[model samples]
Target: MPKIALAQIDTVLGDKQKNLSHIKDYCRKAASNQANIICFPELVTTGYSLDILGTELWTFSELRGGETDQLLSSLSTKFDLTIICGFIERGGSLGEIYNSSGVWVPGGKSWKGTFRKIHLVDSERNWFSSGTNIPVFDTPMCKIGIMICHDAGFPEIARILTLSGADILFLPAAWCIHYKDVWNINCASRALENGIHLVAVNRCGKEEKINFFGDSQLISPRGKPLTSTLGDDEGLVFGYVDFNLQAKTRLELPYLRGRRKDLYNIDHSLIV
Candidate 1:
């Protein structure tokens, strides 16, 4: 089993430096707690709900290895920790913008993995391009994958990660008030179906006009809520995952092996 912690920080809208500093402070605390991996909420470096369509916030966005990436790279090395966080990525070779998440480790020249968001919410469709691939990275404790907010709503993303050898899925989200129940149900279902540990870090507090539901949660492979916290507070949510449990559950249940792909073209539907 490996212990992981989420630094559920309350980010100010459009403030990158303050958010980064706050994240570093939280990571230090996680290190003291001996967490093997530490995660932050979606758009953690720059506040979520920024007007990506407008010029005022556009200046805050960066390329994959821009200023924010360098800062994360430096912090990962300085703290000697495996760090995962969310940022609004700009200027990719494939597109103009992407809602992205990244994973970095100490002494690593490049990031362990990066995931551009595959799903988009209302208004988001206008601002960013969706990613085509679901990728995973091998870490010392387990195989890890990254997802951002809306990606969790789609079950195929979870299946892709699991099939790609992801033992643990790290979700960085800014779950708004209207979709709190959706977040709860979707995360649990993803964990149970894939037989993989899920660590979901969601933002707290209101940003712009959106009211966020701050139930940052960690769910076990068996669909159990291991630990959860709610409403506009900033702190760490910790959980320990046993990779052996995933193997045991999948073997016992045999759900993935007995799928009825022959009966229907599930992939034809937007979300099957």
Candidate 2:
């Protein structure tokens, strides 16, 4: 059994120092609790209000192995735990920015792998470019897949990852209060249909005009809520993932095994 921690906290707009500080504090708490892995919400490093930042959002973006990565890597090493968090990534060329999620493993010097958000929603299109590749990262504990915010709404992304042999899916979202039902349904539906463990973390508190409801939860392969933090507040939601239970659930449910790929004539290009 692996212990997972979801850091559902409030983010300060465009304040890297404060955000990083909050992350470190949560990391310390998770480490103290002997958590194997900890995940933060989407755009946690610089807040989720893209329109408020406007053109200045680029200024907060950092290249791979930059300061934020270094700090997170060091923290993972220090705590002997895996850390997954979302950040604004600076692409190879100028003005190319992405809403990306990074995974830092224990004993590593930098991010082990990163997944950019393929599904951009609303204000996200104004600042970040949509990701092309859907990557599943392998770690000592398990094979992990990442979904940032709106990506969770697309069933194809989760199915693709499940097909790619992802044992667990981590969703880092900045979901608004209005779409609370969608958030819950998507999280449960993805986990149950895919027959895989899903950990969805959402940020809490208000940022400018949007209010975020923190209902971070860990759903079992059977679509049951193992652990959750309800209400819009700053806190850590913890749960345990049993690989044996996941395997058993998959065997009993057989959702993935029963998939009729032959009957589905969906065009590849039409997907995504």
The numbered model that scores best in TM-score is 2
Candidate 1 per-residue lDDT over residues 203-250, each given as its tens digit: 888877888777887888887888867556878888888878878988
Q: Report the C-alpha displacement of residue 88, candidate 1, in angstroms.
A: 1.3
Task: Give a tens-digit lDDT track for model 2, residues 1-272.
Answer: 88999999998999999999999999999999999999999999999888878877888998877889999999999999899999999887657999999999999988998999999998788788899998999777889999988898899999999999898999999999999999989999999999899999999999988999999999999888999476787998899999899999989999999989899887899778
What's each prediction's TM-score? 0.91, 0.96
Clash pairs (backbone) in predicted model 2: none
Predicted structure with the largest lDDT when compared to the true one: 2
Off by over 4 Å in 2: 268-272
Candidate 1, poorest ten consecutive residues by summed lDDT: 49-58
